[model samples]
Target: MKIVEERISQHFQLYTNFSMNSPIRLYVRFVFVHDGMNGIISSDKRRRVVNALAKAFSSRFVFNHIDLNDQGLYCPDYFRLLKDSEEERYIKAKTQRDPNVYLHIYSADTFDGAKYRNWSSFPWGLEDDPVMDGVVVDYRNIENEESYHWIIHEVGHWFGLVHTFENGCNPPGDYVDDTEAHSDEIRGCPPEGIHNACPEEKRAPINNYMNYTDCKDTFTLGQIERIFRVAKVYRPKLLEPEVCIPPCPPPM
Candidate 1:
């Protein structure tokens, strides 16, 4: 808690001006709060799933592997509170303060809201509560091979990405150029009737990671550009090498 209070002093120091191909690194702290053994997954196994998306980031930016920390924990009651309110995120961030940690991922057996696979604090979403400004993910989502991009999609939100149909498709859908604006979210990757709302284009980018379409397998150049842009400014730590090595992702 004291460290969280101390962190605010450096909150204004934005890490920026990185090259497009610089070898950048970001640390993800996975605070595992036990609901039961069902919530836990082996680090090696989790790393395998997470790295698949990390590899995707490398293709666009000089991004390095995410440093993973599984040692942080939350009591059962407090873990449940995570879903009860948005401010709870600020509380958890204070509880799990680590000087070198960059991104925080709260893993529970199941998220309080079962609708989406995972949810995260948007870029500066936790600005008011800087310490807890991270992502919460249900392990089940990332574990599913059919939905491996779950973490990526959430992180994309942290990087200032919005849903493809954000604001119901009138304009600026997802705010990315390469992605088309759909009138509504296309779920389950339906092959037919997936089109943009504004009419400049015919089909939505269902495969785009930002969309909730069942099989999200790609990120357009626009999304990649947007992600790195935010990473450079708002989330500068993600663009720099981690100062302390909590632990590296298991060798791929």
Candidate 2:
């Protein structure tokens, strides 16, 4: 993650004036890995989950398709931290079937022994291995209302946004000037009040989607700009309209 952050920062520095004339429509697909025990998520749940994601990103993402893989593609541990052999097999089996898919998310019944509930590959980090591009989250994250933010947070990273507490409140933190720097991530939800943590005593960005707080719901103006710039620079394929399938939904 640190390596990816550095690459993103450097790229942003090089393309500081990058801008997009129009918003890009994202085609997304969902794959449910059957755990052979808990079964796959229901259609109603899938719609609600897609709705939540659409709401979060202002409807830039389109619901493409849902796939149920009973071929044992489950990620028992952290998806990104899987052993080389396991990772290769998982990526090969979960490979994107639709050429129009800009992003693919996989959900499993358990990431039981993993330290984190979800993982996503940064676009800039996929230069060496593009097949591993995707997001993985525990199935409970989609089912439980309280953990819904986890999906948004991981997607933020996929869009090139980093943690608010990145680099420990130092210069170039998160590479977004509008986001206030913090020494570390604020765990759980805290009371509604001013939370200052940087040396300059600026208010912490507890409400930013890239932050670890449970109440995170919005992205700063600078973060939004950076997201577009990153897409244009590192993931230009996402900006090409020809790559997306027909009937792209209008923004919500």
Candidate 3:
């Protein structure tokens, strides 16, 4: 991952010009890779994944396109792409130049051969590698209902959200004020009642989408505000009126 040397304070300057109440319609383009090793994902499964995303995003997501590429191009070495630059080349060649469409790639192979489920590029946060612009999910991670939150978690990162436990209980942790500070992620469903670990003694954000817990569900107000701010600054094209078509009016 490329290291971004930017500070959170510098990135999220106070700005009231952009309205926060309006819904944001995010356009997404999915590319499924069939490398013969894992076979192609069924259309039903694909729809289910998209539905899950829509539910997670509160119906603010739009599916622009779904395409299957049977080039058998797999990134076996993961990060070492020189030997397997075909996959990179394919992505670069296939990626649409339109900034409104966010590209998501689904493949069967693990990113690091083990313990790696998914990867996403933060717009202007921690990792902002220009080459790695979208989100990539391993097929194994999306096989069950329990793992559906993984997509939401990665998407949160793509929208400039760091982990809930990002700065280890320090100031500017995850750059969100509402979410409590924690030293590390709380994996799986945390037990009922207050679960505080950091020095602040506040309850950990076990249910936040940016957290690693299994019961992930909501994004804090701060996170939502930050997402809009980040989009306004780093991804201005996404907010264009032309990018999202207005809904049809009801009968008069």
Candidate 4:
């Protein structure tokens, strides 16, 4: 999209300083909300999600400032929370928060009022609204490997990736040079050589994070580059050190 390309030219625009080969290290704060009676998302699940992110961003990002929050039993009204203004709620909603966290993520009992298992800060590339930023996921999906990529996919959007079938592969589509054009989304794990509307371009990389495909695991070079560009333009804080990981205590 034009939004992504225009961002490439914006201020905080260190498009040149970026080492072409090195990964951009970023810090993440994971805040978990639950009934005090229930356990937080297990370490196993957390580790899996972390690992998936590492692989997906291997060439572009490194995550750190890994931390957790135990906000017991705050009921989030997912439907209105998403459709209406989210700022009234989550902007003041962080608990056990770390000011240094660059990527603030959460795990709750449900998301989108259970209509959708997960939700994330899309269009964050459009502006800076801390409360409205970051990702929120259902507790159970965080534990399921099959579903966990939902978080990674959402994060991709946060950094400015459009769907693989973005705008039907129209000009400036997905704004990535390496990914193929697709007319629509891939609903689930598609078999190799599945139908592609843009046969003129090679088959779509259906497994890309921007797609709705179930087996997704890749981010094109263009996407990684765009992510870095967008971060500088819209989320420059990610490059700064607000807080480093452990040995640091949760905010009181």
lDDT of each: 0.61, 0.68, 0.62, 0.64
Estimate, for each residue in 1-252, the C-alpha lDDT of model 3 and write its tens digit.
223325334445555355765555555555555455563566566667767777776644344444343343444443222212466545645553344345455445545655556777677632234555667776655566678799878888887888888878677677777887888878879774356557665577778898888899888778877777777667666565545333322222
lDDT of 4 by residue, 1-252 (tens): 455466566643545567435445566666666554442666556767877787777745667645444343344443223322453255335443432245666666554654665666654433544555667666766767888678888778767677878778576566777888888878788785646747668577777888888888888877887777766656665555343555654443
Candidate 3's error at 78, in angstroms? 8.9
User: Which one is best on lDDT?
Assistant: 2
Q: What is the TM-score ranking, best to worst?
A: 2, 4, 3, 1
- lDDT over C-alpha atoms for residue 2 of model 4: 54
Cα displacement (angstroms), candidate 4, residue 132, comes to: 1.1
Worst 10-residue lDDT window for candidate 2 reads 76-85
Q: Model 1: clashing residue pairs?
A: none
lDDT sort, best first: 2, 4, 3, 1
lDDT of 1 by residue, 76-180 (tens): 555554453664554465556542236666666555565644777766444465655666777675556665677778877866788888866565446567777
Model 3, residue 113: C-alpha shift (Å):
4.6
- lDDT per residue, candidate 2, 76-167, as tens digits? 44343332336534654556654224677777654647566688878776566666677777777877877888888998888888898888
Error of 4 at 2 (Å): 4.2
Lowest-lDDT window of 10 residues in candidate 4?
79-88
